[model samples]
Target chain A: GAGVSQSPSNKVTEKGKDVELRCDPISGHTALYWYRQSLGQGLEFLIYFQGNSAPDKSGLPSDRFSAERTGGSVSTLTIQRTQQEDSAVYLCASSLDSLPADTQYFGPGTRLTVL
Target chain B: AQSVSQHNHHVILSEAASLELGCNYSYGGTVNLFWYVQYPGQHLQLLLKYFSGDPLVKGIKGFEAEFIKSKFSFNLRKPSVQWSDTAEYFCAVKQALSQGNLIFGKGTKLSVKP
Candidate 1:
């Protein structure tokens, strides 16, 4: 079975530019999550989506960051007016469900560099 | 708010040596614990997880973690390590019965000398 996949393995852009990162979860996973991994922040959760319920955006650092999952499968994280501090490897994960017992599988991640 | 702490930032050991990586979370409620590993060029993968029944959970590659509720800790250990086992280990936690995100610690990088 295919694991999660993220597109544009590496992206470099100037500060204040907008970037969109895409993620395709496993075939039937209903729970999807986004995280950022940086030298300073380590790994931090950004957002989560479960079924048709409201997405959890509590972990999103600021309003400039937002994500959307369409058709309950693919997700895209967009950063508006990116800053140097936003440069990091963006990771996507998914599980069968939102249960605590279920394990989340991660993707290769897209490395975003704010120049 | 829940947070995870990994005691060591990095550890160096020789092959066949015993290994232990400490992890502690600050949450009084019931929680699920997980250990994830990432090889030098690979994506992160689940090593093991502890939900309820057994406190001692075994994972892939001869890795295991013990969940101590009273201590709020889940320490990963292995009796013998191989050079191939060198990687970054992350400890994560999520509140039980909630559809919350996993809170991860600043990972511990293990360097195994062959």
Candidate 2:
């Protein structure tokens, strides 16, 4: 089966610019998640989506972080006014559903370099 | 808030040496435990999981983990590590039936020398 996929493996942008990272989850996966990993840091939960309900936006660090899942298959994480601190690998993961035990499959990630 | 903790920031061992990576999670309610591994230049992949079952669970590439509820620990173990085992290991926990949010620990980097 095809695994989760992310577009633009690497992106280098200027500070205060906006970037959109895309994720294509495995087919039929109903749960998608976005997480950020800063330098030498752990995976920081960002947002989550299940089916069609409102996504869980708790982990978004600031108002500039936003995400959307369209057609229940693809997701895009947008970082507005990118800061140097936002330089990190943006990861996308998906599972069968939002259940507590669904094993998540991760994509290679988009490494954003905010210069 | 819930969190996952990985004991060693880094572990280095020679080939055939036994390996153990400690993980502890803080969440009072029911939860699911997972161990993920990321080889150099690779994405994260699930090593094993503890949902509901016998505490001892085995995973890919001759890896196993023991879930000790009393200690709130799920430690990854391998009888003998190969040089190819070098990678970053992560421990993660999901609040039981959560909104699909996962709390991950700072990864433990492992270096296995052949």
Candidate 3:
């Protein structure tokens, strides 16, 4: 139970609708990350949050995809106006630090389906 | 930007057979490498990692990986595999200077028959 946990193991939404996925990181973790895994494709980095510093949103596909981490513990990934292409398994990970060497613990992920 | 390549999309082997999975990456700067495995109905778990020091890294489940910096390769190997080794393997990389955001490769699914 110490590992990362994601809510709504699966999500079904209509195209152009909005959906929110939540992640609860490991206790005492200071860094969190979000990634998207599409069928037959690699895991794509979406965003990262390190403590109180500004989050890195370079990997976000569009302005419709947004995420926020409150109090550095729980995070939410909100997809506005979701498209069919946006459907994929959304994974959340957390680590003690943002260092490249740190081991990241991953969640089971939420499978998002856009109809 | 960094990218990872996993040449093997699927592999099938009998129990006790030697196993090898090829992985390569491209990055201009120093990078941290990792191999993760996801068993059926399970989350991804760390298999091995290479940061510095010895290029050969040993991981759990009797698996190991050799980091060949010259070739930009970190290939996973096992002397002999078991049925329990069946899983999807992913290779990932993170730039040493940047924040921790992994660039993962398309996973290779391995099926070991007992």
- TM-scores for all predictions: 0.98, 0.98, 0.97
lDDT of 2 by residue, A31-82 (tens): 9999999987899999899965546788999999988888998998999999
DockQ of each: 0.81, 0.87, 0.88
lDDT tens digits by residue: candidate 3, B1-114: 578999999999999999999999998678899999999999999999999999999999899999998999999999999999999999999887777699999999999999
Better of 1 and 3 by TM-score: 1
Write the residue-wise lDDT of candidate 1 on B1-114 in tens digits: 889999999999999999999999999999999999999989999999999998999998889999999999999999999999999999999999888589999999999999
**Which residue runs does candidate 1 get wrong by more than 4 Å?**
none
Candidate 1 i-RMS: 1.1
Residues B12-110 of candidate 2: C-alpha lDDT, one tens digit per residue = 999999999999998888878999999999999999999997999999999999999889999999999999999999999987767677899999999
Question: Candidate 2, B94: how far from true, in Å?
Answer: 1.0
- Model 3 TM-score is 0.97
> What TM-score against the true chain A does chain A of each candidate get?
0.96, 0.96, 0.96
